[model samples]
Target: MATFDEINVDISVVLGSSEMPVHQLLRMGRGAVIDLDVREDEDVSIYANNTLVAKGQVVLLGERVGISITEVLMRSPEIRPMRTDGPL
Candidate 1:
């Protein structure tokens, strides 16, 4: 059996998203700012192999940017339950 530590997965930290028309996208130029759905103080989503694994916040270290993991998520039934706050 192979060790889990030797396995590799695709990890991504999503900051935000935005929807725009093709015309509007084509009109974008250098220095353009397209607003995102995420707020400045919101925690970003962390995905591993396209699955939500954790949440984190953005931070700046000296001259580079990094994500500081705030919570470690699990994939249990209780954790994967549907939200009761209405449709996403």
Candidate 2:
């Protein structure tokens, strides 16, 4: 497992949606709204190595923002259901 300091986290923030690229992005100025892949009222998921690890609500941290972890999502082990039938 990698420690916090050992990882150069590439964080992604999803809040809305947009279909523009670099050329259009350059045209964006102050107050420009760029949509993301998420929606409002939906719990944002935190991913590590492309796997979900936690869920949280968005919070304002002065100039920047952060996720206030609401729930912790763990990687649950696979379960094979118990058999109830006997050999015939």
Candidate 3:
């Protein structure tokens, strides 16, 4: 088995996303703000290697920004509780 410390994963904190026309995208300039689909108070999605792994909210430490984990998103079925007695 591979050690957790030896595993490498790319993490991305998605603030929001939007779709726009090529012309509009090309017209973007400094100080221009593109509206995102997320709300100010909503938790942001955290991805590991492009896969959703957790949810978190943004925080500021002095001048630096950080994310505080709010919830963990699990995708593996093996992590869930198993049924034994009988099938439904």
Candidate 4:
């Protein structure tokens, strides 16, 4: 069996998103803030390897920041059936 260790997965936490024109995007410089569509209490989407896997909330621990997982997503029709011959 192949070992699960040493495998690297890309994790992405999306707090919010914004849309703007190309001209406005190009004109923005340093210290520019683009308002997002989400509020402070909204849950953030968590992606693993570019796939949406879970949802979480942004947390602050002292000076550092982290994410607290609130829910785990399961894909429909992807779950395998249980073995009928095995004693599971």
Top-scoring candidate (TM-score): 4
- Which residue segments of model 4 deviate by more than 4 Å? 79-88
Clash-forming residue pairs, model 1 = none
Q: In model 2, what is the error at residue 66, expressed in angstroms?
A: 0.7
C-alpha lDDT score of every prediction, in listed order: 0.93, 0.73, 0.92, 0.92
Residue-level error in angstroms, candidate 4, position 55: 0.6
RMSD of 2: 9.1
Best by lDDT: 1
Candidate 3 lDDT, 1-88, residue by residue in tens: 5577799999999999999999999999999999999898999999988888999999999999999999998778976558898995
**How far in Å is the alpha carbon of 73 misplaced in model 3?**
0.8
RMSD vs true structure, all candidates: 8.5, 9.1, 6.5, 4.7
Q: What are the models' TM-scores?
A: 0.75, 0.51, 0.78, 0.81
The candidate with the higher TM-score, 2 or 3, is: 3
User: What does candidate 4's lDDT look like per residue over 48-81, in tens digits?
Assistant: 8888889999999999999999999987766535
Superposition TM-score, candidate 3 onto the true structure:
0.78
- How high is the lDDT of residue 79 in model 4? 57
| Backbone clash numbers for all candidates listed | 0, 4, 0, 0
Candidate 2 residue-wise lDDT, 1-88, digit = tens: 5566686866564454568778999999999877777777788877755666778888889999888888887664664335689763
